[model samples]
Target: MALTFLFRFADDVVEASDGSLYFSVASTKFGLHDWFFDVLEANLPHGQLLKYDPALNETSIVLNGLCFANGVALSVDQDYL
Candidate 1:
């Protein structure tokens, strides 16, 4: 089962060992015309990585403006995360 649906355009997600979650918010619009043009379209509202803390049952934005942030991956070492 899922929890919250506050995400606008969740393209990618990553989970940490400490039970923290990170995800990217791209664009919410869909259309070939809108996809090709528009600064916001190219920007795609990327770079905004969100974090979810289960202990507090809260979610917050960590980064913003990632420019079409579509994917995310973490290194083996949790430290890299």
Candidate 2:
């Protein structure tokens, strides 16, 4: 069977040196299907950045209270994020 809700409003994704996935969840109470509404409700923070370690099978919140936390990315040298 297929699954959904992997992450609500995941806007962007990037990879890290430790084989981890970094992403942004653009809303807490809204999903991608309701992305427009979230955008419309701008100025308020409902977004977050997360780190997923495939090896450890773990997921953690990196940042929160973001206003449309899109374009999740790492530094060029992978030194700062």
Candidate 3:
């Protein structure tokens, strides 16, 4: 039998009060052999900022292709969100 795996690399994350989670995923390429070597070739990790709202049970992409977007924070008023 063949086995399958799901690999996800998350660099940073933040949570919102409305039961929402925001995070960034870094770009990575891998092979069966010496996968760690690929990390060096990743250069600039490009990915999107995602928001998962548990109340609505939906995941939305707030921003895309943000290079090196490591942290996220909401506005003080929360109204701007």
Candidate 4:
């Protein structure tokens, strides 16, 4: 099954070799059109990096408090994000 999440906007997405999905939530308070506003407000880093594991059928927040979680990539060794 596919996992679903609700957020104001989504940015980059990358999949791990182990079948886990890592994605970014651009902002929790604004959409693309309001990107400037979000930047202007500087409102406490409402963005996040999330992870979804199909094997466990669960999703979790890997990181939070990012100014704008816009990118996601795995390390060269594939050992870290």
Candidate 5:
């Protein structure tokens, strides 16, 4: 199913060779209005990397416990995260 929850802090997205989408979430504990603290101090490593598989209409948590994960880009050949 499609994502029913608003991402806490979706910062970036990139399309994969398989047509899936990879994105970044700055912090799950804070929104855009107050994300500064999450990155600045209050919370560290609250970021996450998500993957959306349109073919299956599903979204999965690919990675977590990241430190303010802001920008995300898949490696060439889509071999690495």
Candidate 6:
């Protein structure tokens, strides 16, 4: 299934044991081409970490206010993100 969210800079993605998807949004205001600009400006945190549930067909923001949410991964024991 194709899905879209408010964020356009989704970069890293990791799947959990239960099939949930965890991803990172680099920046809400900028794309890869303007990554330097995003960093140079030092703007307010616009990045975010998100979660997607296949069964529910829903996406939710797990965390926000990040400078640039680039990579995402779960803990070894799957106890944390």
Which candidate leads in lDDT?
A: 6
Cα lDDT of all candidates, in order? 0.63, 0.81, 0.58, 0.85, 0.84, 0.86
Error of 6 at 24 (Å): 0.7
Question: Residues 18-64, candidate 2, lDDT per residue (tens digit)?
Answer: 89999888898688788878788887778988888899777888887
Number of clashing residue pairs, candidate 1: 3
**Tens-digit lDDT track of model 3 for 1-81:** 422223244566777777788876553233335435445555644555777778877667777655545567778866644
Local accuracy of candidate 5 as per-residue lDDT tens digits, 1-81 = 446546889999999988999999988878889987886764467888998998998888898888888888988888897
lDDT of candidate 6 over 1-81, digit per residue (tens) = 654677668899999999999989988888878887667766677789999999998888899888888899899999989
**In angstroms, how far off is 15's CA in candidate 4?**
0.4
The TM-score between candidate 6 and the true structure equals 0.87
TM-score of 4: 0.85
Instruction: Provide the TM-score for each candidate, comma-separated.
Output: 0.66, 0.79, 0.58, 0.85, 0.82, 0.87
Q: Assess the local accuracy of residue 74 in candidate 1 as a C-alpha lDDT between 0 and 100.
A: 77
Ranking by lDDT: 6, 4, 5, 2, 1, 3
- Candidate 6 colliding pairs, count: 0
What lDDT is reached at residue 54 by model 2?
Answer: 93
Report the Cα lDDT for candidate 3: 0.58
In candidate 6, position 78 carries an lDDT of 99
lDDT of 6 at 20: 99
TM-score of 5: 0.82
Candidate 5 residues lying further than 4 Å off, grouped into runs, are 1-4, 40-44
Candidate 6 lDDT (Cα, whole model)? 0.86
